[model samples]
Target: MAKKNVLIIGAGGVAQVVAHKVAQSAAEFGALHIANRTQSKADAIIQTLRDKGHRMPFASHALDAMDPAAVEALIRQLDAGIVINVGTAFINMTVLEGCIRAGAAYIDTAIHEDPARICETPPWYGNYEWKRRDDVAKAGITAILGAGFDPGVVNAYARLAEDEYFDKIDSIDIVDINAGSHGRWFATNFDPEINFREFTGTVYSWQGGEWRENRMFEVGREWDLPVVGKQKAYLSGHDEVHSLSARYPDADVRFWMGFGDHYINVFTVLQKLGLLSEQPVRTAEGLEVVPLKVVKAVLPDPASLAPDYTGKTCIGDLVKGSLDGKPGEVFIYNVADHKQAFEEVGSQGISYTAGVPPVAAAILVARGTWDVKKMANVEDLPARPFLELLGRMGLPTRVIDATGDHPI
Candidate 1:
């Protein structure tokens, strides 16, 4: 098969890692192009690739990803066969449309969000991306949603349990613990606006064959994970649960994320004061400003945390089910070190974890392993291939079963 040209549609921290990973595997791909709202940001990524002595064909462009016409034009200009969208979640639908129109395979790390809304309806994919399923099928182009670590790899983990370890699945509990510290007073690991938006609304989980809603930080549990050790995680809504529940309807699906007391307190203050609202409010000077955007503007960019970031992150799926007509459980997970990620890709662990998997998915598309040519969530495809590819590409998978801990 001919190599596919790849285009990355964001210039954020995750995009940096994506660029590096793609360059490292450039021989498997054709030309690489990156486009962002700021061309300089894209250029910086290309410069980093060049600094690392990657001589792949690379170019950068300034783009308004929200505009489908602009996105389609860029894809056509490059004849990009695969588009990796590490861009903000707000641009997902538009970028996906462009890919479909340009006949390019589409991949994104998160579900799409409306800039003016937070935590809209449930089966969130149905509210946006899945609405375009017929269009993607008609176009006959592969579209993979939520291909990041939590949603991406975790989705694959649940599938792995179904495929290899379970007869009848009972539950999938995804735990995300970031034991890393950026040495900052307070900062989000990714986009502050997006991060805050995630918690400002209702938390949704799939339980009892229905969507259950709760406030962020309302439900908590202690997880004795691998590298991160014992940590407290709160029940939270996430991209993987929606799709995973659909695939394993009999299984209860829930996502839990670790948060320090400091973060919770600060988040509570900001949220209570309406500082995290996506809706605009008038200032004393009558300037219309979005409180959340203003707060985001004042916070340190998530990309800047890499240099001082130290520690590790443990994220995975703890699956429970029946095997041989008996109860059983397995924890399928990965432990990523922030400093190691910085040394390798100039990105912190959060970005590194979220960034690497989409590129792996892209490689599968290029190699025809995951080129299903339809709109599918990560779990909709085969699991082992994706996990094994991730293992070779820096994020190795481990599992704890009745037999004990071992590599997958």
Candidate 2:
């Protein structure tokens, strides 16, 4: 296969990690390009590459990814064969369309979310991405959805269980625990608006072959995880569940995320006060503003917290099923340290974990390992090669089974 030039959209925390990792693996690709609404941010990332002595041919561009025509034009201009979108979730569809038009492989971390709507119907991909399945297929370009850690790695974990460990799968419980602290009074790991938008809506999980709904934080369980130890994780709606359920309809699929009491208290107060509302309201000064955007503007940017960040994150899939006619369980996980991530990539663990996998996916695409030339969730592809590549790319995988815990 010919070397594919890479174009990365968005210059946020996750995008930073993606740029760094792509630079580290620059030999596999023809050239590297980074684009964002703020060209300066993208340029800063390129400067960081220079500071780290990565001499791969790289340039930055200003892009408004919401405009499909502009996105297409940029992709064509850069001749980007693989477009890594680490932008806000709202731009997924537009970026995917651009890739389709430009015939570039697409990859993103999260599902596409509407700016006006909080939570749409279940199987979120159907609302936006999956609708373009025929387009991607006809275009003959790969589009890998939800390639980040939770949705990305966790999806692969489920596939790994089905492939190697399970005869009849029963359940897939994805737990995400961030024991890291950015030393802030309160701030989200990623975008504050996207972070708040996630929980403010109904929490949906797949159980008993049906979609189950519950309020956020209404269901909580203590998980004795490997590195993070005992952490309380609440049942949460996530991207992987939607795709994973379609693949393993007979098995229960759920996502749980750890949150401290302080976070709960503050989120509750914000929700009750309507500060998390996405809808615009006219202020007393006759200025219409979205409450959620205002709160996000007031909060510290998620990227700035990396400098003071400390601790680690444990995120994985705990799969339960019958293997060899006997019930068995396995937990496939990865632990990332914030300080270590900062030392290497100038980002925190959350950004590092979310950022690294997509580059791995890009490498797989460049090497023809995951270039299926169609739309797919991470689980829809082969699991071993992706997981093994991730292991070699800094975010190593670990397994805990009846035999005891060890590296994958």
Model 1, residue 112: distance off in Å is 0.5
Model 1, 213-263: lDDT tens per residue? 999999999989887889999999888888888899888999999999999
Report backbone clashes per prediction: 0, 0
TM-score for every candidate vs. truth?
A: 0.99, 0.99
Clash total of candidate 2: 0
Deviation in angstroms for 399 in model 2?
Answer: 0.6
Which portions of model 1 miss their true places by more than 4 Å?
Answer: none
- Candidate 1: C-alpha lDDT: 0.94
| lDDT, candidate 2, 164-282, per-residue tens | 99989999999999998999999999999999999999999999999999999999999998877999999999888989989999999999999999999999999999999998999
Q: What Cα-based lDDT does every candidate model obtain?
A: 0.94, 0.94
